[model samples]
Target: MTATAPHFEAPPVRAPRRSVQALLEARFAALLVAPAMAVIALVAFYPLGHALWLSLWKINLRFANTPWVFVGLGNYVDAITDDARWLNALRVTLTITFTSLLAEFVLGMIFALVMNQSFKGRALVRASVLIPWSLTTVVSARMWQVIYHASYGVFNRILVDIGLIDAYKPWIISPVFTIWAMIGADVWKTTPFVALLLTAGMQLIPGELYEAAAIDGATAWDRFWRITFPLLRPTMLVALLFRMIDVFRMLDLPFVLTGGGPGQATETLSLYTYRVIFTDLKFGGGSALAVLTFLMILGSAFIFIRVLGAPVAGAESER
Candidate 1:
């Protein structure tokens, strides 16, 4: 009789998919995303559109009285076929980006390893390592300019004292050596930053893995190659990507130190773009060059993502 009399209530139902509450939540989400989309359009797409419009004209400020004439893609054509200096700048930019980043990665990894060790003075060492990175690019370039001076520079003096050279050479004057000097300065200044990133990555790795590897009789080199490098690959790729982008857009050092001098040996795409826009006063050509440079950078990022297998975590989660 009790069982027959007993009754139970069903679970409460969820609101309908197209209900007022669901529609309100959907609208709120769209509203939140709208601001970001608007900001991106304003900051990024607007400039790109303006550049595209500018690129279609022949507007040289030097010709103050002349009107803006449409040249269509003539600026782009000249950049590829006619402008030798622009081509040279592209070559130099690629050279610096590749070589400097290579040295930075290797040296940075070494510094990271040293800093990751258990030591009494580790904090001090880490601080000292970051000093060069903390200094502004302009300050570092100007300082290196003095250091690379032919006669009175510390570098030349040390080389002479050590018998590496018979005389103080004009390091910045030679086209061949000028890039090397720039690379040296860049590597010295930014390697510490790479090291800092790598050190942080290394710290995240569990010590248990290393201890287990040691128990299995793995040598230091084996542990590094098998465990450390494999684990730190994502961090290394991220550091490499950042430095690549930075070096691609490098201007402050070249502007201050080389001025794209010694026969245009150190002219980067960014430096070249600046000179074209301000020095040559050809806004159309400069805008075209800017667009081309942007495409190259995008291509490089694509290559890195493919070669390193470092799919962005946020992108993966979104998918």
Candidate 2:
């Protein structure tokens, strides 16, 4: 009997197999997503590939019977190294981007803080704050254009009333004022969006943390810097990313407000690209500009994800 028991071996352990139902469910989910994937590939990827292809060839519609000439990054090289207007556009774009971003962020933080405070008309105030942002960009630009009119504009009236200027200034016509005026309008329109996003993020922060900080004898500013600011960083980064992408490709405001005018003083990359493509009939050059803009935006997003993603993820995990 002992010899017989010793001769028996334990059954080998086997991993549990996935059920056919689970496999079927996964396949069904993939099938459900296929249509959306196909649409994206068709609408987005196809156009993007076409643009890249077109960027390599010179296609000037202005010339009769001219065939597509392969330039092999000539447009890109011209834009980057040889094109003075392109360089100036780049400078103007960067100036507006950074300046407007800073103003919006600071004002947005202030607005968020004020809105976060309990008040009798907080809801109304928040709704009012969102009004500027709610307007379509084109409409907002048109409105601001009216506001920046040299004569009979409220902006000049306010300045004159405050004794800041002797007369109404030509804000849109002057090169010095044109870009700044655009920056101001951009900040006014977008700060609310930034504030709204920050407010949402602030809501996620636990009240206990603030209370504990207050108990530790931390001042309001101290608490904000030490607790609120740190916690809000992830949200700020996300807002910055969105705003950067938008402002980089900015067209409507500049196009409508100044028409990239006052002699190309306020010309953005997008507006310049538009001019090149449609106005100058240079499809290849315009495509190259579009591709370059896309690359810049993509690079910026990649940097944000790679650099700031870790901290954001860590914050989420901690929470």
Task: Please give each candidate's TM-score.
Answer: 0.89, 0.91
In terms of lDDT, the poorest run of 10 residues in model 2 is 9-18
The model with the greatest TM-score is: 2
How many clashing pairs in candidate 2? Answer: 0
lDDT of 1 by residue, 129-195 (tens): 9799899999998999899998799999999999999988888878879999999999999999999
Model 1 lDDT vs. the true structure?
A: 0.90
Candidate 2: residue pairs that collide = none
What's model 1's lDDT at 268?
92
Candidate 1: residue 297 lDDT (0-100): 85
